[model samples]
Target chain A: MQTLHNGKLTRSVSLEDRGWSLGEALFETLLVQQGNPVWLEEHLARLARGCERLQFDFPERALRDDIHQLLSESRDDRAVLRLCLSGDSLGVRGYGAVSRTPHRYCQLAALAPPVRQYWDEGIRAFVAKTRLPEQVELAGIKHSNRLPHVLARAERKARDFPEGLMLSASGLVVEGIASNCFIAVNGELKTPLLDRAGVEGIVRQKVIEVLRTQGVTISEARLTLSDIEAADELFFCNSLIGLWPARQLDCLSFSSFSLCQRVQKELESVWYV
Target chain B: MQTLHNGKLTRSVSLEDRGWSLGEALFETLLVQQGNPVWLEEHLARLARGCERLQFDFPERALRDDIHQLLSESRDDRAVLRLCLSGDSLGVRGYGAVSRTPHRYCQLAALAPPVRQYWDEGIRAFVAKTRLPEQVELAGIKHSNRLPHVLARAERKARDFPEGLMLSASGLVVEGIASNCFIAVNGELKTPLLDRAGVEGIVRQKVIEVLRTQGVTISEARLTLSDIEAADELFFCNSLIGLWPARQLDCLSFSSFSLCQRVQKELESVWYV
Candidate 1:
């Protein structure tokens, strides 16, 4: 696949790059529909915040130029864009040497077929054993140190589940493998507070915004497995697939999704662009 | 600095590499003295176990060949070698696609001058606000997702402390920025139990084995700041810097180090080799 590395057309970076060695980086995955990113500014805002947390300067101009240069020549909808930024190298094993010079690597690829299928038919999710650590230092940012997600996603695939849910190390349900989880509890949407862990997904914010605009209440609550068990409806949302209404969580099948359907409908307007 | 990429001489890897994008990798830092790596097999064993936890196939042959190719022609007594291995590129943003094809990058550089100084003059330590997340999934393995260490180290630097001590989110002291901590209490050495967080360092294992062989007691225990405050002596140990007897922690001064000196002397024979 063709890639834009620091606004240049190449697929190679320095082997000493911090992203490779230390994971001193953050990334944002977005959906590009008809040559335009659906929520470009919102994703950038989150990315900028991550850069701030990591003491990295956002390479905004270079990144935007790369996006524009690529999109100007293509009109493909359902394309996935992954923008990664980090402060260059680890400075030769000096843990204190956090570079301020940012490196931007962006790739545009076709959205995987399973994403569309999962979005349509919902997905079967099992709670994974890989627990998210309570690291407020890296919370709410889509940083690149994603071994927990990788392990959890693998666990789900091993069990033949399309998606997996993860809990904090203390066992509070936090999020899905790649999405923010939302539950309709007593007709109000409640998601786990991301004060301690989990990525604060932009699509989750969009869902909350759309629902709130429609006078539907949504709040962040410390959720557990029992809270999920007693929920009237369940769903997952992310930037790429937009929303996946849960049809089955373990053995407790979700045969009905009135709120989930409404969420998908509301998201379709912006997701489809 | 000379570099080896997958047993060949090169200084670049694919930008698509999972090590760059997702930090799906593990690395070991060793002191190469007089054409031989200190504790090569021991470090490899720890790396292999980490590979197992990450569901990675340790690329033993390629890595061994790379080390042999790189080290054969050099006889630098005080050199630093960083060996990195990762299953290659994230396959097209498919989180489920875990590539088993390993990418090995090795860098051999002259040991930085500060290492020797730090080894001589004991360092001042500070309690870091960046707590280690209590995720047992990642505990004990030196995987590349090191944002916690990065942040804590930065915090320590900002406060002008040479080394930083991190606690678990639940307020239990875990480990140092790059070292495993040991404290002496009533003539026995105790370290923080790493079941919840922190990297189980190689030198830490070596120190324990040496101290045990010397008939000195060393055990893992859940440590707190109060425990550190009450310690008779304090020290840090890692692969590169064998041991640093801490002189001050926050504002607490440590003047006597009977147990610390004994442990350091036991490790010196092995470390100075």
Candidate 2:
């Protein structure tokens, strides 16, 4: 458990951690802007929901303290903070956790190069060969079972592209390699519903909130490749990269990003220092 | 990779291991009987194949050395050796691996109370509420993305059942919580196909090999709940447990495990010391 400790935190994890064995854990990637973790409440709340789905208790106090401790020691104003909560170490057997107690870890790293370039100029995208399988129980949570995402990212790197859209086995578009995607077609904004597959990204939620307040109609739907292909504009969103408009996907190209630009401008303070 | 190291091994794992954060790893659970790992070659070969799919090179020599070291230090004659090969620690980013190197870890735990009881008297099972998603890319390998399996096991525990059967989104029977399922109906022994989901369990493979040699007809097919319900016999298999016939599943009961006993007798040496 994320027990409150006045002592030092260990940097290493136990070898028997189920998070390392079965991906039986939940994680959140938060942006630390100027020594402050942005949207701390939202990230921790999402982590709590994920912990509930994974049957692990939310170590709220320990996690908050861990984040505070990491940020205090970090010199970088703008950094990336990752919090991982997994089953605590115990003598192992099969998949069952010997003790229900869990381990909490927080590590800080440097942020990627300026995310604004992608937001302004947009980024090229491709449809990844990796498919997102529909598992309703695990849907919408940012758990650690992310091999599919890793495969898609590797595919994107090999193809020399920055991002890619993943589709279900039935050819329904789901999400991006590491972000959630949205498309505007016929002046209606739509994002893939993560009720069946994909993560309900925090930035995507914020973008929806901001746009809905601005009188823009946004809805979650089961999107297909044809839907995005016929779209007037496309963009991707995540906690780190606020809004990255898609200029091209495969051979198709887009020249419009009005909604994308609006969302980016509105959330600039939240994602950046 | 599994590089040959002549020095002592580290007992702790890096917190940044993708295996812990993203479940980007492959593991093998080998049954060590009398200071020797059973089916060692087969397990390593499966690990190698899993490495191929995950885009990581297999550390064959290093894994062997780790197994030897753990086994040498172990006092339990019959033990469970877990080999976890995960991506080496690196600076965090998206899902891409900065360095292609991987970390291999081997730990030994005392075997559970003699598995002979479950094999002799059989066990009760229930159909799990958790569904195994159709992940053809990840199918048939013991990769660490096993939240589904863990959930199923937990459901079994909650229901007070010894085991549970996992099904796909379309209600097709796939596998057991931690093993493979086989059923005999009208003299035909059939197992669920792993083409779209489920692990191609090592013991399930061995059972097929031994059964086919004895002229028993065994087929891998797309099975349904109706199929198992109409079966004359049913059993589960895995490396550590060998063969465990199912006496009952939920309300349905089986009257015979004749074919199961035959297979058990044929492979006794492989499973037991």
Candidate 3:
């Protein structure tokens, strides 16, 4: 594993030698292909944004160089690189790398192809009985406090559903466990604005950008269950899977929508591997 | 650095490895004293509860034995032990020691204390403008998904306040960052129950038990900012620092009441210092 701290590579023998033990770190996961990371700038931007939200210094230029160097040296055509910034007596900064492989447990068991199939066809989703606590200060940035996602995902898995939708305590729809939910209403695409909750997923941003360029009006607004249920089409988006069309939601299904197919085709044409 | 898996100690190097990169782990932090972890049962219960919440297997016996052995050999009279459980190919358990010392940092050079003498004499507090998201499943467990606390604490620190009084998105007061809040209202002490959106802190539980045994009536209820502002006394409690008296909050200040002093003395008398 290649590790970096404050923009310099180190042969540290112990994870403890870094300030990460204090849980003062933020990270990013990137997809590297052919010894080059895809969407490298976007991933780095998100990482820097996370650091900004956490009030930590981000060495963007140094990080870019390090990521480029590591990707150049890695032999695997496809791999996953993780960048972590940890805080200690010195300050907040740390990074690490990993060659992507299907592990028997987390990477494999925790993530199944059946789950990914939601990206191809669509998914049946249900609103979680639980509501996300509303903290405006923490609404959008992803900072590793993921118990809510874990719990919500467990609930969804128990119900035998592909994905679970969550709502803020104020009764406004937020997003999914690991993806952002979007709906097409009156020919315009709308998703829950992350002004209050949910992560500003990289894929979601890309989709919005792609759609905007296609003359498709996209908006961020507070959505409710009723809105989702009445929409012309529904889908979820995240960095890894790009986009997943929603086939059904608690007693409601929209598998036959032409718009869903159109949007899926358009997104996949650009994003699908 | 004592480690155990499935309740037995083996020289298996796999057990000592950190597999957190795969994201299949849950952990708990507990205070240990004089060869015995304080509230040991409660901590384990929470860990098991978190595992249940996340649908992960809880290695109860092994975890307990590991803690038991570590505390027995430690030289420090008090220490913080962190137990991590990960679902990986190698195995799913690990233990590590955490620093007892608190690390304090400032955003723009720590602002002057919000209320002078509150550090020593305690201070009154007001409900923050922010509200915690309502995720009932994750409401009361201490999980690694602590981004909320980190964000809340940052906001609180930026405001030059020692604490941020959080409310649920539904406008119900919850608790503070890393602390449980309580107030003496209408001649009776009351705290917000942890059924919905806060950690069921071991220290909070112990204080409630102690107060109940002393014939001091304590009720777990939804407390409003009005209730707190109107209360005859206010204080915050946690495991690390027994109880801190609040002196001033926003525009309100209450004289140091004798009830707070009496409770402080009673608590200090039995505190594990």
Report the candidate with higher DockQ, 2 versus 3.
2
**What does candidate 2's lDDT look like per residue over B1-273, in tens digits?**
121122246656766578987889888888888889988998988888898988888878877777787777778877887787788647556788776667777777787645576889998888999999898899898899989988888775733566788999878999998889999988879999998998888888888898899999989999999999999998988888888899999999998998999998988777665
**Interface RMSD of predicted model 1:** 1.8
Regions of model 1 farther than 4 Å from truth: A112-117, A269-273, B113-117, B269-273
TM-score (second chain) of model 1: 0.93
TM per candidate comes to 0.95, 0.95, 0.77
Query: Tens digits of per-residue lDDT for model 1 on B24-72?
Result: 8888998887778889998889889888887778888888888888888
* lDDT, residue B273, candidate 2: 52
> Of models 1 and 3, which has the larger lDDT?
1
lDDT of 3 by residue, A4-54 (tens): 444455433122322222233455655554555657688778767877766
Q: How far is candidate 2 from the true structure (C-alpha RMSD, Å)?
A: 2.8
* Model 2 misplacement above 4 A: A1-7, B1-7
Put down candidate 3 lDDT per residue, B170-256, tens digits, no spaces.
777788765787788666779997777888887677767767777888899988788877888777766555676777766877665
**DockQ rank, highest first?**
2, 1, 3
Residue B2's lDDT within candidate 1 is 76
